[model samples]
Target chain A: MVSKTEETQLNRLENQVDNGGGGAWEYLCLVRKLKVRRSEKVLKHGLSILNDPKKRSALGPEEWTLYEQVAIAAMDCQCLDVAKDCIKVLQKKFPESKRVGRLEGMLLEAKGSWAEAEKAYSSLLEDNPLDQVIQKRRVAMAKAQGNISGAIECLNKYLEIFMADHDAWRELAEIYVSLQMYKQAAFCYEELILSQPTVPLYHLAYADVLYTLGGLENLQTAKKYYASTIDLTGGKNTRALLGICLCTSAIAQLSKGRNKEDKESPELQSLAATALEKDYKQRASDKLGLLTSALRSLKI
Target chain B: MGLGFIIGVFGVLILSHAAYSTIQYRGLLKIMEEEFSGPPMNVVLELLLGFVFCIWAALTVPGKFLSIHPDSEENRIVSLSANLDFMIFNHRAKAFPLEIDMKLKH
Candidate 1:
């Protein structure tokens, strides 16, 4: 993660490149390396280079990669003609590339010609059924056509083959959440947590799902996960702090008629509240009063 | 450059000076035809000081190693995932008049 200073520097470079300044090639490389989405700017700047004979040739062997990048970016920006043009160049350059073939299938999918796209993808898959990207495209195509169940089924199949893929798990979990299938979503999150326990996003998402389930046991588990999220993020995440307070309040409400020993502790809530207040004081002093009143309403 | 960098540079200069002084002292001893005693204590001190300064500079120049996956405001993960291969924000329906229907039962 870039600090504020580095982030500003990147923004400045983006603006300069956007205005047709130099470093367009360098900026595009940076975007790809960092996996940041800058499709509109990439389409514009990438076309500028591709459309120029001298500048395009100056890239030498890197020219084909630039073509692929522009093609993908153009597809994103709804410039099908530009995408077709770039893909045509790539196809001419490498006639038998499976990668280029995948691009063709993608272009057809983008054009909404489902039958032709299905045939293209099927033929490509026959060559290499282990292609992860093609399988994901199938799920994406199902989703694009508003077939959520089909998408989920495709994703589950993909997971059976590639269980280690975090993105597929995340997508499946999100689809299950949308369907309000909390148990399935929780299982997906469990898979995610098992795969990469350090990623705070999955922890936070799992906590949210458990909280939504809202049973006595689920709430207790949700509180633990939320605390783990806070620990993973070094206590800077405000939502996790609020989750602690909320879980404590709910536990208190549920435990009123229970034995004293069965009641959950509350000191963790007070500590979370203090940390939240300190964070607010440091970042938004004027909103401290509001935060105090909100915490007071939570009755901790 | 900060003070540590200046000290590093200074340390390099001193190391070079120590090497030069050793060369010059050897030349002098050969000219005077005297037995080469251990050259001078000052050269060893200069080498030690330069070593310390260079180490300090090496540690100070680049600063600390930060966590690249921070989810704070400065470096929040804007996109859910890269998921570039599956991005379906726009399609032929928006770009041009549709010739075929995608919503047809498959």
Candidate 2:
């Protein structure tokens, strides 16, 4: 039984479709989202409207964007033939469009003709060297081919042009970590922290990298960052609590013979360990026993 | 042929420098061991050997070089488009909806 809210939404959608409103495609997309298995119903409705001679002629130039949306929806529904038909219509309507060219390249990719797809994107880039989407696609292709360095190089070049892209920075940082380039990964996280300082994940990640690098100074910094992470998360982060405990012990060992006293006190390590034990018991009881054993092995 | 020779010379130069550094490190370790009972020489030797092999592998591996075939403007297009296709498909399932949403608003 459809609820009152769902029925109201469906009625609104029907009214929009009946009146030839601009939001018909959006309505169908919403329906597609609600019942994914009923996408064929939405596609058929869209196709019927497109097929009607009067309706086709009545649609404005901007409304023609619906064809691409319908094509993508058809693709999602595994109706390749329908998608191809829509793409053909779109191509005929906008023959010289780079946007259409991108869709064509996407179709080639979907068809598993990677080399041909690459050629299409390359030509598109040749026409406009600063095309950001095409540039990102090039990096994605290198990654798909398992060319890590190539992907890194492409991302580096793209960042040179668009340095403010945080998503790209995060991706580059992850790739650096995968390559075990902790210093480089640290630099990326530093960029992220500088841009958005309050995000606990960046602090946690930066701390992890510094800990892995393992110098007295780096470990000290790592401990500080982990503390910041815990504070930011309101002391609810088990990993950050564990990090404080581990860093305390490690720093104590590293500074044993050195002039510098241990920055992390034994009392602090005990307190963090106690908090971690209680939190793990509350959240992950099964891991609680293992955590105790691990702490024992560490002699913390 | 010229590129190969240059690569070969570069590899040799790097290997010689690495070897020189390893010998100097070993001597320093030996002196430290005599004065202060430093770490085991065998462990230090193994680490140095591993570092040298890593550098050698990186230098000699010609596969690291970009090997795009039929190197021409057309082929460059092929490579670039292939890259773009990769990016598109990779983010399609997740990011396409966001793209469409932005398009609809515009």
Best candidate per DockQ, number?
A: 1
What is the DockQ for all candidates, taken in turn? 0.14, 0.03
Residue B2 CA displacement from its true place in model 1, Å: 16
Model 1 in CAPRI terms: which quality? incorrect
Go through the candidates in order and give the clash count of each.
1, 8
TM-score on alpha carbons, each prediction: 0.76, 0.55
Indicate the fraction of true inter-chain contacts that candidate 1 also forms.
0.22
lDDT per residue (tens digit) for residues B1-106 in model 2: 4555565566556556656666676688778775434345655565566566556556655555643332222221110001112333333543343222111110
Model 1, which residues run further than 4 Å from truth?
A1-12, A19-22, A260-265, A281-290, B1-80, B90-106
Candidate 2 residue pairs in clash (backbone atoms < 3 Å): A117-B81, A118-B81, A118-B82, A119-B78, A121-B81, A122-B81, A137-B83, A137-B84
- In candidate 2, what are the lDDT values of residues A1-300, reduced to their tens digit? 122345467668867776766566567655544432333445656776676667666776744676876675565554556777778888888899998887777667656577997999999999999988777777766776678999999999898889887767887898899999999999999998898675677788899999999998899999999988776666766788889888887887887788875354557677788998988899899998999998887663
Could you give the TM-score of chain B for each candidate, in order? 0.57, 0.33
